[model samples]
Target: MLRRALTNQITRQQFRFYRVNRSNTVINFVPQQEAWVVERFGKFHCVLDPGISVLFPIVDKIAYAHNLKEVAQDIPSQTAVTMDNVTVSMDGVLFYRVVDPYKASYGVENYGYAMQQLAQTTMRAEIGHLPLDRIFSERAQLNAKIVQVINDSTVKAWGIESLRYEILEKGDIHLPQSVMQAMQGQATAERKKRASILESEGERQGAINLAQGQRESIILKSEAEKMEQINKAVGEAEAIKAKATAVAQSIQMISEAIKHENAQKAISLLVADKYMDAFSNLAQKGTTLMLPTSVHDPSSMIAQAINIFDTLTTKRKDMKSIEASNEDKKPEPEK
Candidate 1:
């Protein structure tokens, strides 16, 4: 009976030990932007998200931990041959992010290394298709092509998205010394050619503008001269018209005065006075003078002058009577 009691005590101790072990629990604290992959019996069971996660201690295991963040990878310098058979060394950077944790874990052994190799190979292949000059000029297009090719192969299978690829700046692309020297000379020549063309164009435009200015100046000067001549002609014509009007008014006044009875006597006295004035000034104006024989006889000279004036008046009256007779003889219109 004592042996049976000892056995029962041992069995109670064993039950207590099993119950204590069964009460134990496993808790995991997951950080932000992280994914913990759980495997049950060597197979994927579930993914634990950020926060508290409980797992069975013996059966559930965290197989892989993945950081769900964007990453940038630097590409190492490598030599590539262009289609024109020129060799160049270049380097760049790549940007990417993990979209699916499970696929990233299981799709490839090492996605980062895989991506690097793919980028290098793609870059070389693209460079091979272009000439050296075009390779530099079309760098943006080359980067886009590389990204497209990488994403095409990795997006679904590897759960990695390639955001962009950028080739490094100036010093990243290295050419041989001889090639660089030749390129520099070519660039210098091209710049000189452009400068010369611009200079010639400027000279041509300046010459054209100068010619146009001269033409305009000539046209203005000719117009001004023509206007001057026209103004002078108009002034001369106006002077002649005014002089003719004054002469006509004076002649009309003289003709009316002559109709008075004492007009002839007044005219004789005016002729005598004009004769005396002309004879006195002739000695001061000139050394030589031809005087008529009757110059010493003032009365005789006045009588001669009056006779000539009366003869001219009689002829003027006869001409006016002839003009009136001619006007009367003209044929009238058959009104």
Candidate 2:
């Protein structure tokens, strides 16, 4: 082993003197997502990319090495007072990456600590501009504003790119006991008010429905009554018409009988029969006393009925004779 070491040293020295040591130089295998800053004689040089690269042992050296992968920084909780004098402590995580290794190595001493501090300061300032209610509701906006402020100011000069900022914990944000109680009471009152309004609306709808139903019921009933009355009146009118027709038909038959000069005698006998029946009914039921008057005799009643029929027949005959005479007086149509 000692002999091999001596041989390797002689070989390296020979290669260096003959200007062939570049081939034997140590090759740096930079892994993916990483960068190496090579400096020649303590001056700025090119950034070494992925894969194998070499720097002269005596001249060029890797001055700075940086991992290009994303980095996360956990920020400790800090108290922040809001515009309305509400104090809240908040903690978060910040994600960043080295965009320019030269600037990251030279532009700032420590970009991670600087990013953390800037994030805190910006967070405090942003919180101070907002009210307590907004702090709870606008957490996303708060994180975005903090990221933007840090990225625009310190992160830009530091060659560090801010990817994201997430609030890990929202520390206790306190309000006065009286204020909390008052808010709770207000919420209760609002809920009760809504319930009352809904109940009243339901009752109003019920009343409207009931009134409409009653109105419809009344209208239907009135229509039914009107129809019944109309039907009754129509029935009465039809009955009157049928009775009149029957009466007229009976009169026509009587007139035919009168032509035979027997109608008057028949009517007299029929009237005497009806009087006998009515007197018999009165005597049986005893509804009235049937004291017979002097003119109540059946023979007398029959004689009177006969006289009345004769007078009516004579008047009818006279009217017919006058009608015949008038027809004869009218002029005949020329044919």
Best by TM-score: 1
lDDT of each: 0.83, 0.77
In angstroms, give how far residue 332 of model 2 lies from its true place. 2.9
Global Cα lDDT for candidate 2: 0.77
Which parts of model 2 have CA positions greater than 4 angstroms off?
1-26, 54-58, 170-317
- For lDDT, the strongest prediction is 1
Candidate 2 at 95: error in angstroms?
Answer: 2.3
The backbone clash count of each candidate, in order, is 0, 0
Candidate 2's residue-wise lDDT over 1-335, tens digit each? 99978965664454231111122256778779887777778798788888898767767877677888888887767888889886677888888888888888778765666677778888889999998778879988988988888889755587888888888854434456775787699889999999999999999999999999999999999999999999999999999999999999998987687667556677767766776687678889896684656346767766665677678768988999999999999999999
lDDT tens readout by residue for model 1, 178-215: 99999999999999999999999999999999999999
Report how far off residue 43 is in candidate 2 (Å).
3.5
- TM-score: model 2 vs. ground truth: 0.59
- The residue pairs that clash in candidate 2, if any, are none
> What TM-score quantifies how close candidate 1 is to the native fold?
0.67
